[model samples]
Target: MTTATRVPADPWPAPRASGPVRAVVRVPGSKSGTNRALILAAAADGVSRLRGALRSRDTLLMAGALRTLGVGVDTEPSPGATGADWVVRGGLGHGDGGPVAVDCGNAGTVARFTPALAALTRADTRFDGDPQMRERPLTPLLDALRQLGAVIDGDAMPFTIHGKGRVPGGSVTVDASGSSQLISGLLLAAPGYDRGVEVSHVGGRLPSGPYLDMTVTDLRAAGATVEATPASTGRPPVWRVAPGPLRAHDRAIEPDLNSAAPFLAAAVATGGEVLIPDWPEVTTQPGRMLPALLEQMGAHAERTPAGMRVRAGDGLHGLDADLGDVGEAAPVLTALAVLADSPSRLRGIAHLRLHETDRLAALADQLGRLGADITVTEDGLAIRPAPLRGARLDPLADHRLAMTYAVVGLAVPGVTVDDIATTGKTVPEFPAMWAAMLAGPHLASDNTG
Candidate 1:
């Protein structure tokens, strides 16, 4: 496989071994929440204003997709609005029955969700994306949509979506091993169908299953009826949603706990403490495991009313754990494991290989570049802590890998990450955020623990 060769201008920060890195940082809006809110707002009846919305590439792509489907999305200053909020004037369905092509970039959410919404319209629209996105599978979602009477152009990425304008939703089986996006897509668009969609799983286990809950919760909040059945071996879990008009409710997007993991992990690896303000106490994000996992590694992780506090221990221990649910945070966690006192084995992450890049291999290759002892397997990674002699790191066109390795740079000297701009896919102000956190006082000496 080809690797990213371009070196980043503002590469890894200088390694600091004995200082406390303590600062209270406010995380950006959740990418998952923003995408769902935007889509739900687009399907709502009246104007829906979303606050603290993430203005990243993925959400921006979703916004652009909404506009193509006749939704009026205004980002400019609106009368009596606080902060940089987006005012989405809803009630605009797909118009003119014309062919509209959407370039979702590398956003799988956009690629999956937009097609289902597009199928709800009578418009003959084609959904396309970058080469990587085109390579990603959408056959499961397409098959389910086809079962609902929506005409799809073969089993391809740049396929045409000949919308039936009215979907005859019924029961269909989908393989969610590839992605949970397939399930989320069907759930989001199923509400508007004449006979709401009922989906069942076919093969392999579902990864990131909690994300599907987020989708259902968001849909229910938007006034859609959805019920999920228990999962059984060899039988797909069933989901039933009733056809109805979505309610126009003012919703607050949750803070991204997953996005906050790398910073917390950075604190654990570098003998510092980082505070993330406004982290939700009740969140389904699998990345919430960071605090517990860090504690297991001999760090102190405390959750206060304000937010979360993470402090590094004298010595960190390696952990053998299965992270199938919160697999998105695996790369950074594995990077942090490289600083532990022993070897760490992270299993049940095979789903990660299907993301924007082959995450498992990408993490292994990049960490190996930094002199880390990493072994990439079909299931997951086995990482042994070593004195990571910083080397030029390649981000493999993956945003998570780029951002995760940047955290590795805080504690390792000479670590450089290429294609840093790829972080715009999720966190827009990455290097800036790192710089801000680094300017704070070190937490190792501050015995506030």
Candidate 2:
């Protein structure tokens, strides 16, 4: 079993920080990239090897879903704390057995992407997820499938895809303002459509362009032709994926820069230094916005030979910025904003409500308990520099929320985060990494543990 350091069965008393952070932390592979690669690989025609794929609950759940679709995904147990490598024999065609069934487990990617692949087969494929996923939006993607001539029953999760073993893939438009998953879901499985796929958005604005960029980059690398209209052109974004067979190839996943936010935020909050090595010099990961965003907020960040390094400035400052393109960093930025000398206003992430949880509401409610004067707005949240007191924080079973609250505990006392186990969703090594960061390794373990 490739479990992460054997976590406790009960809620972890989150490790607290005593002083400025000084450590070299290695984050795992990108879940976004891994899940996308898995879908594309499953749709391909040959064997593919994916090295450095994240082995967390989310990515594993994606692998399981692909397995249900009759794709062969073989993973080697991770050795020495690194991510596992996957040997996937690609043949998305139906096996000699019965039809498929996928359990999304609240993973937005699986719930959204797999149905598109199922539409390529004439089998009766069932798609469902946890109760919360049933609440999130999947109608946009489902509507697009219906437009492409796939007979789908039900609007969201707990639905069935009655594929006629052929999709008359062509032009289809859907409003993806709620989440970019809808856009990506269509593009990934488009190659299998008999005529390929052409998707246009009919929404106010797309939420995460970088994520789609990652999708396009991966798709084109796998030999699929993709054309995307510039969103700045005033017309809604349009994507054209030509009909072709995806060429299976080897992929080396990059470290999840988004998951690295909190650990790097440790240095920013305490005027210390932290190094995250293997940082990609050029990549589509949205966390690439860090070098500039942190710099704008009173920190010196640069790409070093070791990795991305950040040194705390004279002190953390505040800035008003629109985080529409890179919304995942909002929670990490909000935690730092509460400690800034000046107030901070984070805008352009209204779609975050449709995430694993209502992030804006959860942030407002949980951070409020920490004595932060935070206001949850329709698009985002506004936080003022207020005297914060350590209070019981509820993670709402969201991994990002748990990681964000843990960073806030570095400056505040008596901050206890409920559902620390939820961090396993993306970063199962979170507890050990947090512990190592606080104790400074060669130091004592109980400093925060």
Query: What's the true lDDT of residue 351 in model 2?
Result: 90
Question: What would the per-residue lDDT of candidate 1 be over residues 1-449, giving only the tens digit for each residue?
Answer: 33334445765443444455776666787889888888888888888888777788998999998888778887744233222467787764546667887888889999988888888776788888877787776888888888888888979788888766677788888998989889988888887778898998878878888889888888888888889997876566889999888866666666677888878887887777888877788876666777888887889988887678988888778988888888888888887788788999998899888888888888887788888899987789999877778787778778888878877777777877767888888887877777777776444436655
**Each model's TM-score?**
0.93, 0.94
Off by over 4 Å in 2: 1-11, 77-81, 96-99, 232-234, 441-449
TM-score between model 1 and native: 0.93
Highest-lDDT candidate: 2
Q: List the residue pairs that clash in candidate 1.
A: 20-442, 20-443, 20-444, 21-442, 21-443
Worst lDDT 10-window in candidate 2: 1-10
Best TM-score goes to which candidate?
Answer: 2
Per-residue lDDT value at 379 in model 1: 88
